[model samples]
Target chain A: MATEVLQQDAQAPARAATLYHIENPEVENKAERFLNAFAAVLHFTDYKALLDSYCASSAKCGRCVASCQVYQVSRDPRDIPCYRSNLLLDVYRRHFTVGGWLKAHIGGGWSLTDALVDEMADIFYRCTACRRCTLECPLGIDHGLITRLGRYILSMAGIAPKALQVSVREQLEGETRNTSKLPEPALVDTLEFLAEEMAESLGVKLEFPLDQPDRDYGFFCAVSDYLMEPDTLMGNAAVLYAAGDWDRWTIGSRNFDAINYGLFYSDWHLERIIKRLVGEAKRLRAGTLLIGECGHASRSACQFVPVFAGQDELPVKSFIEYTLECIEDERIHLDPDIVTEKVTYHDPCNIARSGWIVEQPRRILRSFVKDFVEMTPHGRTNYCCGGGGGLVSMDETHEWRMKVAGRVKAEQIRATEAEIVVAPCANCKKQLKELVDYHELPCRVMGLHDLVLRAIDIPGGKSARQRQDEAALAATA
Target chain B: MEHWLELARGPLFAFTFLVMGLGLARHVLLQVHGLVTRKGQRLRQAPWRRIASSTLSWAVPVGHLDRSTLVMTTASFLFHIGAVVVPVFLAAHVALWSGFLGVSLPALGEGAADLLTALTIVCVLVLVAYRLMTPRARALTRASDYGVLGLVLVPFLSGFLAAHPTLNPLPWSWMMLLHILSAELLLLAIPFTKLAHVVLFPFDRLSEVHWQLRPGAGDRVAAALYGEEAHV
Candidate 1:
C-alpha cells in the first residue's frame, strides 16, 4: 500500500491505508507475473515459512522506529521498518493465506494492482536493510530480510531499478565481467602504477601477483578498488606480504572482484557470482577466499558460500580477520607512532550487525591510532552509513543520501569529533565520504586498511631517498 | 437477560474457544508439516544451537530495553502479564474452565484478581494513549490493531464491573453477557489476526531452520523468471 515518493518531511509518510484497485491486463499480466513470482518464491523454497511467520506475527510495536535511520531522519510513516515490511506481508496474508481468502470473499480485499506494485517498488528500495530493527524487535521480525524478499520479487517482475539491473547484467555478460568495467590490462596497469607510487614514496614494493596457482589466499576485493579505493587494495596486499613470504597469495586473473551486488537484490545473481568466484578459487587451488575491505562482499561470501559450495569446498576470510591474526602472531608489526590523530570506526552493518567482525577492527585500530572515540551507539548497535543495501551505488540519489538517508549517520560521525572515520565497507565509505563532504564535517572518511597502510612497518623496507641513491649508484656503475 | 448471559457463556463460548484452539493448532501443524516435508529438499544440518538461543533470548529481550523504548516495553510486558494471568488464574474463570473440562489450576484470590484487572485496564489505556499520541505508532496502527485493543478491554472492564456488583452500571445479567460475549469474540480473533503473534512470534526466529533452498534452485528461479537461457 506504500506508494508515495519521499517528500521533504520530518513526519513519516502514510502508505495506502486502503487498496481499492486490482489490475486487469489484456496484453501482459503483471499481476499474474507478481503472483507467479510469489508462488514461485513459495514453491521453490522455504521463504513461505518466514512470510507466514512475519505475517502472523510482526506486532506493529513501532519500537523498530527507534532503530531505523531513514525513519529517524525523514519521520515518514513509510520509512518505518515494520510498516515498510507490511507492504509485502499484507499481500501475503490477503492472497496466500486462508484468512485473506475469507476477507476477499466476504468483503472488499486488496489485490495486486499496478499502483500497489509501484508502491512496493518505491518503498522497498527506500530501506537501507541494515537490520538494526531486527535487534530492536522483541519478536525478532527481520524487516531487513523482508525488504530483500520484496526486492527479489520485484526484480523477478522486471521492475528493478535501472542502476542495479544494468550492473549485474554487465558483471555476468559484459566484456569486462566486473561492475566497474575494469579491463584486465587496465587492472594490471593500475596495480603497477600503485606499486610504483608506493616505491617512490615509501620505498615499499609489493607484488600484485595474478593467476598464480595453488596459493593460500585467493584475493577477491571489490572490483571498484581497481578504479576507486586503491589504497584498500594496496593495504591488503602489503598486509598479506608482510604476514607471509609474500608469494603464498595470488589475485586470480579470472573473476577476482568480490563486490557481489547480487547480495543487494537477486539470489540468482548471488548464486551465479559466488559460483564463478568459487570456480576461480578452485581453479587456482587457493586455500581460502580472502575478501578485501568491502563489508557486504565479505558477508555475502562468508554466509552464502557454504550454502552453494557445502562446508568443505572453500573457506572465506575477511581481510580484517586475517590482519588481526597476523598482528596476534607477530607476523605484521603496526607502528603505533604513525597515527597520531583522533580516529573512530564505523561498523559496516553487514559485518557487525550479527556481531561477526565487530571487535577485530577495533582491536586493530587501538593497536595503532591515538584517542579513538567510539561513535554513540557503536558496535552491533552502530548505525548504517545510510548507503547500505546498494544505495550508495545509485549515483542519482546523492542529494537524498546526504540529506535524508545519511542524516543520522552524519550526526553520529560529527558527535564523535574524530578526524578520521575508518569505514571498512565499500558502500559505507562512498556514502560517508559524500556525507562528510556535503555536511562539511571535519572528519576524513577512509577504509580501515587505508590508515593501516600508513601504520604498518615493513621489515628491510628502504626510504624513498635510499631508493633514489640506489638508482644514482646503479647509473654511476 | 439471564438467557443472553447463558447463551454467551455456554455453547457460544465453547464454539469460540474450540475455533481458537483448533485454528491455532492447525497453524502449528501446518508449519511443522511445512518444515518436515522440506527435509528432502536439502541435505544441510540445522544450526540448532543458534536457533535455540536466538529464540529464547528474545523471550526476555532485555537488549531492546533502550532508554527510548523502556517505558513502552515495560508496560507491554506488564500488560501482557495481566492479560494472561487475570484470565486464567481468576477464581471465577477457573470454576468455569474446571466445569468445562474438569481441569483447573490454583486460582488467584478475589482481591488479587481485582487488582490485576484494574492494572490490565490501566495498562491497556496507557498503551492505547501511547499509540494514539505517538505518531510512529499511530502510523503503524491499522483499524485492526485498535479493534484488538478495544476487544481486550471489553472483557476485562465488563468482568471487573460484574465481579464488583456495587460498581456495575448495568444489571448483573447484562454485565455477564457483555463480558462473556467479548471474551469469546477475542478468542475467535486471536488465531486469525495479528493477535496470533502471541504464539507465533517464536516461529519467526526458527524459520531459518527450514531454509533449504537446495543447490540448483537459484538456476531454476532464473529459468522460471527469465527463461531457460537466463544467466545463472
Candidate 2:
C-alpha cells in the first residue's frame, strides 16, 4: 500500500507553484545529462563534503521557517527552509551514507525519480537566497547556500527558470550587447534621447561618456533602466553633474548593463558575467567599477569580482555609496524643503543581508527627507521585495510572487504609511511598484536617486520657467 | 543485576568513552580538513569581534529566536543547561570523572541535582509537546527528533530513580546500571546524530560568516573548469 502511494506520488506531475512548464522530454533528458555530469565533477566534491557536514546535524529548529518570506505567506511545510534543504540532503544520504548504502542494497532507501527532480526544482527555485534565515539560526545553517547549490545542480540539468536562462544566454552569447537585447546603435540613440530629456526636465546637460579610457569609474546599471526607469538614469546623471565628477565616470559602450542574471541561476553564468564586467574595466583601464542601484548586481560584483576576476585591484562601489559620499563631502547640496512627503527606504535583501550595505542608503535618505520612517524590521531583517532571486524577470511566477512571497513586504510598506517608498535596487522597485498596485495602498515607489534628483540643486541650469518651456517644446516635438 | 551494574561501570563505560572520543575527533578532523583543503575564491576578512559577539548572543534566547518561537527557545535553553549540569555535577558522575581524569571537580548536592534533573525532565517534556503540537515543528520533526528526546530522557529518569531509590520499582543497582548505559548510548550517538551540534555549532556559524562576508575560490575553479577568458 505504501509502495503504491510512493509510485503514484512519483508519477504525478508537481502542481506546486513553479515558473517553468516541464512537459518537454527533450528538456528533461538535457537536465538529466547535466545533473549526471555535474555530479561526476570533482570540483563539486568539496561542496558535497561541506553539504554533508552541516546537514547531518540540522536541529530542524524552524527558526529559519519564521524568517523565510515564502514560508510566512504559504504556511506550506515544503516551503520550510530545513525541509527544502532536506530534499537534497536526502538524495545525498541515499547515495553517500553507509547506512543509506545498506538501505539501498536492501531496497528500502529513497531513489531520485523524475517526479522528485521536478518537485526539487520547483521548491528550490521558490527560495530567494536572501540569507535572512542564517541570522536567526542557532547553528547558522545557511539554507540560502543550500538553495543556491540546489539551483546550480538543477541549472546544470537545464531545469532552471526559462526567463533567467534566456537572459543569461543573451547576455553571454546573443547578438545584442546586453540582456535587454539592445543593439549598440539602439543603446546610443537611447542615451542621446535620455540626455535631451534630462536637459529639458532637470535643466541639466547629462553626457553619457562612452568608451572613455582611464576614467576614474566605469558605471554599469540594469539595461532595463534605459527604457523602464529613465528618471532614475536622469537622477544618476544629475547627481554626477552636480558633484562635478562628470568627467571622472564613463559608461562602457560595449558593456553598459551591470545586471547579472547569472547570480540568480548558475555559477557558470555568474562567472561569465563577472568576467565580462572585469574585461570591460580592464579594457577601459577604469580605476573603479561603479554599480548602479541594483541590489544583486552590486552584491555579485562586490562579492564575486575578486573571486572570478582574480583581483580586487579595481574596487566595486554601489551608486548609493557614491551618492552618500557626495552628500557627506557636501559635493552636492540638497534643498530639504523641496519635498515634504513622508518617506521610507526599502533595504534590498542582497544589499542588506549579503553585502552589508544597510546604513549608506539610510544616511542618504536622512540628509534630505525631513520625515523619514523606518519599517518595523528594517535593514538586514527586512523581507525580500518578492521579486528577488530573479523572480522579477520570470513573468510566469508573478502571481505567486505577488500573492505569497511578496505579501510580507507589501504589509511592511503599508505599515510605513510613507507617501514615497525609496528602494535603491531595480528588482525591489519593480516588485514594490506591482505590490503598491496589487495591495491598493496609497504609496509610490521611487529610486534613491529619483529622490536625489528631486532635491539636488544643480547650479548654472535653466530656471523653472525656462525648463518648463523646454519640456513643453520637447513634448510637442 | 550486580554484574550488569559492574559491567556498565567498568568495560562498557570505557568502551563508550573510547567510541565517543574517536567519533568526535574524526568528525572535527573531517571538518578541519575540508576547511583547510577548500579550493577557489579566497574568503573576505572575517569580522572576528562581530562573529564572537553574534555567537554569544545566539547562545542565549534573547534575540536569536523569533518572538513567535520564544516558548520553544526557552524550553531548549532550560533543557540544554539541565542536561549538561545534572550529569556532570551529580556526585556519582563527579566521582567517576575524578577517578578517570585524576582531577576532582565540585559535585552538586543530592537535593540540588535531583531538583535540576526533575526540572530538566519537565523541560524536555515541554519541548516534546511543542514539537508535537506546533504545525511547523510537527512538519520538521522526524523519528530522529523523538529518538534524541528519548535518548536524553532515559538517562535523566534513570539517574533520578537511582538517587532516590524508594521511588523506583527496579532494584537500586539496576536503575544505576540503566543510567550509566543510557548515558553511554547518548555519548556514542553524539557525533552521528543531530546531537553533533554540540561539537559543530560554533564552526557552522563561522562557516556561514565566511561564505557571506568573503569570496572563495569560485573564480579559480571556474577558470580551471571553463577557461581563463569569458566563454562569450
Candidate 3:
C-alpha cells in the first residue's frame, strides 16, 4: 500500500494538497490571513516590481532546467527551475501587475486559489536554492531567489514546513540561544567530553574556552555539532590549540551556535539571528568573530553581518580561512602521512557560490593530504550537496532530498573515486554522510578540520596516558 | 503603395524610434530609481568591474551555455548576433543612420548581410520548431513567445525579399514598406514584451553583487516589507 502511494505521488507531482494535509480549519484561516497581510505589506511592492520585470522579459529558455538537480533527477515538468519560479511569478502577475489588472477586468485570467497556494508551498520547498541554475541563466533570473521568495510568501501564510518553522521559533524565543536548543550546562559538558576524547585518542588535552571576554576571536558552530559531530568539535579545538591561539579564542555561553535557520525561511528570523551573533560578539568583546564548519552560517555572518550589524564592528571570518592562515604562518605543523587515503572536497553552495570561500579549503587540504582529487566541477561551479538551503534540516523532505536533490552530488562524488570526502560545512557533512549511506559509496564523509585533527601536531600538549607512562618510567629510573 | 512606403520611411519611422527610445529610457530610469530608493545596509563597495566581466562572459555561448542544451543555445546565439549585427551594419540601415543621426558607420557588404539574414531566419525556424517539439520548451511556450519569434522573422524575411526584388513575389516598394513596418512593430514592442531584456539584460547582470547571497537591494526590500524585524 505504501509502495502504491509512492507510485501515485511519483505520477502526480502537482498534488501537493494530498501530500500535506493541513486539517485544522482555524490554522488554515490564520495562514490565509498571514498570507494576505504579507501581500499587503508595502515593501513587497519592490518584489512585485521585480517579479513584473521577470514576467515581462522571461524567454522561458529552459536553460535552467538542464542545470537543476531536482528537474534532472525527477524528469518532471513541474520540477523545472523556471516552472517552479513561475509559481510565484503567476501569483505576482495575477494580482500585482498592470497586465494582471487588465486581464482581471477582461476575465479568464489566473486567480490564486487555495490549491495553487498549497502547490506553491509544496514545489518551492523541494528546491535546495543552490543557485547553480542562476549561473547558467542568460537573463540572470535567479530561480533560487524566486524559490526563497515563494517559500517566504508561503511561510507568511503559516504553510511552511514544520521542521524549519519550529527551529526558527525556538532559536528566537526558546530557552536556548541556538536552534538545537542545547542548554548551557549541556554545551559545557559536551565540550569537556570532546576534550577528554581527544586526549584519550590523540595524546593531547584540548580546551574549549567559554565566555572569556576580550578574546581575539569568538568561535561559533552549529549546536548540533555538540551532540552529533563530536569529532568536528574536537578537530576545531585541536587545530586552535595546535596553533597556540587557544588563549585568545573563546566560545560564549550565549550564541555559541552559528547555525541560522532564518536564512532558509524568513528574513525576520535571519535579521534576529544575525543580531544575536553580533550581540554575542559585542558581549564577549572579541576582536573577530569566527564561524565554524557551517556554510549558511558562515555566509550569513560574513555577508549579512556587515550589512546588519554595521561595518565597524568585529570582522567576521570563516574557521576554514583561519585554519589556512595558521598553516601559512606555520603556527601549526601537519604530518601528511597521517591521512594517506585519496580525498576530495565538496564545496558547500553557501561557501563557494555565495561567499567565494573556495580556495581556502583546497589550500588547507593540499598542505596535508598526499592525494587530493577534485570532483568534475569543483569550486564555484560545484553542485550542491543536495542538502543545501535548509533541506538537511527539513526531516520531512529526507526521502525527496536523497532521491531528487542529492542524486547529482552523489554521482559527482562517485565519479571522483575518492576514499574520503571532506565537506567543510556541517550541513553538507550531514547530507554527504546520508548520500554515502544511501548510495552505498565506499567513501567516508568528514569535516575539513577532521582531516586537520588527524594530521596536526601540537608541540607541548601530551596525552594523559603519555604523561603518566613517562612519569612511571622516570620513577623506575 | 508608394504613399504608404513614404509614410513608413518618414513619420511612422520617427514615431517608432521615439516610442522605442522613450520606453527604453523609462524602463532603465525606473530600475535606477528602484536601486536608489531601496533601504537598509548597502555594500561597502560596488563590484563594477566584476559585474562588467560577468556580463561579457554571460553574453556569449562559451561559458554560460550548458553543454546539454548546445543546439538551442547555439541557435539562440546565432539569431541574437544576426538580429543585432545585420540590422546595425546593413548598407541600407547605415544610410538611414547617416541621414538621421549624422553617423556614417561602416556597412556590411550585400552578400555578407544576405548570408547573415538567411542564417538568422534558419535559426529562428529551428528555435520555433524546438519550442513546439520539446516537452519542456512546449510547457514554457506561450502565444507571446511564438508571436515574438514570428514578429522578428517578418522583418528579416521582408528585408531579404526587398534586397532580392527579382525573386520577390510582392512588388519592391511593398516589400520595403513591409520590412520597415515589421521592424517598427518590433521596436514599439520592445519595452512592452520580452524584448525589454535587450535593454535590461546588462543592468540585471551588472547590478547583481556576486559576493552577497542576495542582491544588494534585497535587504531593503526585506526591511520595507517585514518592518523593524528585518532591519536588526
TM-scores for all predictions: 0.90, 0.92, 0.91
Candidate 1 local lDDT, A1-477, one digit each (tens)? 232222222134464331111122222565677778877776776688678877886779889999998988888888899888888887788889888899888987657665566567777877888989887787878787888888888777666666777778778888877888888889889979888876664566666788999888899998888888878877887787678747988887668789888787777788788888888899999999999999999988887787777544699999999999999999988877767899999999999987889999999999888789999899989999988888888776677778888999999999999999999988899999999889999989999998888877666675324544576698999
**What tens-digit string does per-residue lDDT give for candidate 3 at B113-209?**
9999999999999999989888878767778889999999999999998999787999888889889999999999998888998877765563244
Which regions of candidate 2 fall more than 4 Å away from where they truly are?
Answer: A1-17, A22-25, A29-38, A462-477, B40-50, B207-232
Candidate 1 RMSD computed on C-alpha atoms after optimal superposition onto the true structure: 4.9
lDDT of 1 at A417: 93
lDDT (10s digit) by residue, model 2, range B105-143: 899997888888999999989889988898888878888
Q: Name every residue pair that clashes in candidate 2.
A: A31-A157, B40-B216, B40-B217, B41-B216, B41-B217, B41-B218, B44-B214
Deviation in angstroms for A338 in model 3?
1.1
Fnat of candidates, each listed: 0.57, 0.39, 0.30
Question: Quality of candidate 3's docking, in CAPRI categories?
Answer: acceptable
Please state the Cα-based DockQ of model 1 relative to the true two-chain complex: 0.51
Docking class of 1: medium
Clashing pairs in 1: A11-A75, A12-A75, A12-A76, A12-A77, A13-A76, A13-A77
Q: Write the per-residue lDDT of candidate 2 for residues A1-477, one digit (tens) a residue.
A: 122233365575565545655324356554354446445432543565456577668888776777888999999888888888777777667665686688788976556666677677778878877778877888777778777777766765657777777777788888786888888998899889988877777667667899999999999999988878988888888888888998998989789889998777666677778888989989999999999889999988987776667663479998989998999999987777766899999999998984379899988888878999999898888888888888888787778878998999999989989999999888999989999998898989999988888778777785334544565698999
Q: Which stretches of candidate 3 lie over 4 Å from their true place?
A: A1-26, A29-49, A462-477, B39-49, B206-232
